[model samples]
Target: MDPVNLLFLVPAALLAGFVDAVAGGGGLVTVPALLATGIPPAQALATNKLQGSFGTLMSTWTFWKAGQIDIRSMLFPVVCVLVGAAAGTVAVQVIDASLISAVIPFLLVAIALYFLLSPRAGDLEAQARVSLPVFGLTVGIAVGFYDGFFGPGTGSFFAIGCVALLGMPMRKATANTKLLNFTSNVVSLAVFALGGQIIWWVGLAMAVGQVTGSFIGSHAALRFGAKLVRPLLVVVCLAMTVRLVANPQHPVYGWVSGLFSG
Candidate 1:
């Protein structure tokens, strides 16, 4: 809220937006920054989403304007996000997220390994494998649930889902991901604000930076197309998975997370 905080946040937001636009892990950057400022974790997540919405909106708009996204039928996914996330948020109060945390590393590892092994997985800009409407509905519900319940690495989830199910190119998948992500974030933001948890000034400062960073990052994706996008996504997913497994709190932070136990 102060000038010093604003100064620190501006840079953080811009970098967060750029990372978000590039690979869908901006929260990995912005959430920690918010937490570092002594905010509660819930408020930090809510405010980060508040600021992140601006960049995502810009990224989505850029994709739409460039003919990279099919917006007319995007409503189903967007709406599903709003509904599914509301439910997920409510359910979280009763459900333990420990299982999800335990499982997600394996999921990320599998996704990363798939991409790493198959070099041509999403490289071809061919006809989509699924109908637009069905495609939209499937991912909307599944990812909406995830984003609503536990939201780290959501961008990666959407990206891989689009590629694996719809056979969409990575560039287009990233664009569409932003639109769907925006809807989910908006739903969560509304809830957080309702609970009086969002830090308005912090969200505001970060939002401004999000717009700037997203514009630049969006253009970069447009320029490089799927060739650059898919591999980078795989790498990011792998990195995020490793981070999750390590938990940053385990005795063997680097090596032991791969060995799983029931």
Candidate 2:
């Protein structure tokens, strides 16, 4: 990338890191920036994973240092995330992404609405509805697989699962989400790297920004609690849903366009 083009990405990556650390939606920013810079979709996805891994790592470290996450307790979930993400990454290389692309927007919309309407969704901690082993096997594997394959809204999904099933407060859920996000990201990054799909120069450049932004964002979450994080989560998910559906190649977009033309 040229100096000017590279400069354009730095601020976007920085902002993405911050937003992602808080409520998960950084790809809503960074992926578009990559595509705008003319990176092909596969390379863009791979490169985004590279920078995202850095941001998630920083966020996870910050949350851990603050005593928000229990790494030892999360080992099983982390292992599930690794296995699921590896499967997803490998599947994506062979499968037609359109298979799931059509459905994710609706799922994102549902998640946004759930948080929007539920007053207690993330505000207060409650009793866990299911055992940790069950949560790990189900939500962990499903969301981790989605993260590796489709690469958007993974954080929000994990956050909701933590809140609804694990009964963690918003802040704690966000913290734990980062840990899982980091795990899936690292696993996916390895797969992408092995396939030689990453744009190293661009990814590394963005990663520098991700580290700094995530640090600030994580601290912000620790300070503000649900008041700040909740709204951001809704906005990010809705925004990502719109971004995906607005693409003319997207099924929803195509359907809408066809209706209008007809």
Candidate 3:
């Protein structure tokens, strides 16, 4: 890459990591930046995984260290996510994604709306409706599939579901999101590596930026209450959903098309 693009990747990855840490859609930023590099779609996606996995890992660790995660209860869900991601990746290989693409905007809108309507409850004082195992498996299977197929609002979905359905606080929900997000990324990255689509040098550079951004983002989340986080999450999801609906694509993903075209 030239100096101009190299410069761009740093800031792009940094910003992507920060937003992802705060809300969960860093790909909304990094994937387009990769596409803008004029690489192939599969190649860009592969390189994105290479970089993103690192960012997710850093965020996951940060959350864990900060006393946000409960690993024992999370085991079942993490495994479910791994299995679901593998299944989704395999299914994507055989089926056209047009149907899911058509439906995703609605799904995102629902997620955003759910949060909007329940603003007063379910952040810190929420209660779990099922055993940890049951809850984990449910989210793991459903969201894992979504991540592997269409990934615009995966983080947002994970965060919100844990908060609303499982009655997790926003801090705990954010931490748990990182863990599951890490698992899903691991699945996708493995496939991309096997296909020889990753650009390691660029990925490593982006990872540096992502890790830095994650640390900053975690601090922001810790400092600000969910009263602040709640709306930002909704707005990001709304923007992502609208972007997907108008363009008839994955919304957040449409930016990738522009990058390659430009």
Candidate 4:
């Protein structure tokens, strides 16, 4: 790749890491930057997973060190996510993704509305609505599958599940989200690696930026807690929704075009 591409991608990766650490949707930045560099879409997505792993790992470590994550409690959910992501990855090879793509923007909008309008969305922990085991089997697996199948809004889904079902505070939810996100990311990365889709040099170079930005962003999250996480989550979810719908080939775009033309 040209050095000029690195100039664009590295900075984008840095910003992506920062935003992703705070909330999610880092791929919103990095994927486009990679595509703009003229890499194949497969390589761009694979390379994103490579760099994203670094960012998620860094943020997870930071959260763990701060005592925000409970690894022992999270073990089952991690395993569940592993299974779900693996299944989803395999399923994607055969299934049509258009239906899922059509539905996602609406779901994202609902999530954004929930976060924006719900008074207690991320304010504080309430009584747990479900046990961790149940949460693992349901939200964990579902979101993991979604991540592997569609590859967007995953962190938002995880964070909301933690906050709403598990009754975790915003900071704690964000911490746990990173851990689970890392698990799913690694599963996808391995598949991509097996297919030899990644560009190593680009991924490694962006990883440097990912690590640095994640470190800073995680610290910022710790310091500000819910105040920072809440608004950022809303913004990230809505932005991702827009990006999805804006794609000309996206199902939502086609549906809208048909509506207007008819």
Candidate 5:
């Protein structure tokens, strides 16, 4: 990449990391930036994952150090996410993603509304609605698969699941989300790397920005707790929903196209 184009990615990656650390729609920014650089779609996706892995890892470390994530307790969910992501990566090649893509925007709207309308949401931990095993199988594995397959709003989905199903506070939810996000990101990044899809120099430059921004964002989340995370999660999810729904390849967009054509 040229110096100008490469330089443009730094700030974009930084902003993405900051948003991702808080609410998880970082790819909503970085992936578009990579595509704007005129890389092929596959390379753009691969490079975005490469940079995203760094930001997620930084956020996970920051959360872990803050005593938010208990690795021992989370081990099962972590493994579930890893396995789910790997499966999703393979499945995407065979399955049509339109069904899931069509549903995600509506799901995001519901999640956003639940957070917005529920006064007690993300405020404090309540009794979990599901056991750890069930949560791991349903939310953890499902979201992990979604991350590897479609991936626009994986963080927001995880955060919502943590708050609503797992009954965790926003801060802890954000911390745990990072762990799962990092796991899925690493899984996808490795596959992309093996496929020779990543643009290494570009990925590395953006990764530096991602790490720095993620560090700052994670600390901010720890300091501000629910106050910062809740609103940001809503915004990021809605934004991702809009992005996906507007995509020409998305099923919803295809419906829109048919409407206009008719």
Candidate 6:
């Protein structure tokens, strides 16, 4: 809550919003910045959701106005995400998150590789591999729960799901990702609010930055389409993977250290 911290966090949120709007790794920036301010981890995560909601809302609105998202078709997925996020948020209060922390770096690496190697990952809409209902039940619930529980690369998860499973173009995938992400974020934010974990002033101040950044980022995505989104998605996932493993306490670091010592 120091004015000094605000000066740092608000700008971080702005940068986060820009990256998140385009490819969905905003938390990679904002969460660490929040933590660095010496807040409790729970409060930092809660405050993150509060600021992130503004960014997602702004990007979602931008995409909607641009005719990129179809809200009515997304209703079921939204409901599924809401349910999953609510459950995950509650579970996180009691569960140890170390396991997830250990596993996510590998998963992010895989995602980055998929984006990097896939010839047609986000180029165009193809035939859906699964029905909408199936996507809602599977990706919606799973990624929503992940967002509520751990929440770093949620936008990437949603965007990839929309592209690979639902067969959406990159721009449309990014648009819908924001909407579904907003759903999970709001559900998690509400639970955090109920637990009295959020710092309103900090969250609100960062939100101003988030809104401005999201507006610009969403427009850039619209302008450049796949060329912008695909590379950013790969970079964000890779960056998140590195950030996660860089933590000395992260299980991957320990595992690698043991391997080298052995």
Best by lDDT: 4
- Model 2 has a clash total of 0
Q: What ranges in model 4 sit over 4 Å off?
A: none
Judging by TM-score against the true structure, name the best candidate.
Answer: 4
Tens digit of lDDT per residue, candidate 4, span 162-259?
99899998989999999999999999999999999999999999999998889999999999988999889999999999999999999889989999
| Candidate 6 ranges with C-alpha deviation above 4 Å | none
| lDDT (Cα, tens digit) per residue for candidate 3, span 126-212 | 777766777667888888988887677889888877887788878778778989999999999999999899988888888999889
lDDT of 5 by residue, 141-202 (tens): 99889988878788888898889889999999999999988999988998999999999989
Against the reference, the lDDT scores of all candidates come to: 0.80, 0.91, 0.82, 0.93, 0.90, 0.91
Candidate 2 lDDT, tens digit per residue, 1-262?
6768888898899999999999999998999999999999989999999998999999999999999999999999999988889888788889999979999899899999998999778788899999888988999899889888887788989999999899999999999999999999998888889989999989999998989999999999999989989999999999999999998889999988999999
Error of 3 at 89 (Å): 0.7
lDDT of 6 by residue, 1-262 (tens): 6788899999999999999999988998899999999999989988998999999999999999999988999999999999889888878889999999898888888888887899677788899999888999999999899888888778888888999899999999999999999999898888889989999999999999999999999999999999999999999999988888888989899998899999
The lowest-lDDT stretch of 10 consecutive residues in candidate 3 is: 247-256
Q: Give residue 52's error in model 4 in angstroms.
A: 0.4
Clash totals in order: 0, 0, 1, 0, 0, 0
Clashing pairs in 3: 244-251
Candidate 2 pairs with clashing backbones: none
Comparing 1 with 3 on TM-score, the higher-scoring candidate is: 3
Candidate 3 lDDT for residue 43: 87
lDDT against true structure, model 5 = 0.90
Q: Please identify model 2 stretches exceeding 4 Å from their true place.
A: none
Which of 4 and 6 is the better model by TM-score?
A: 4
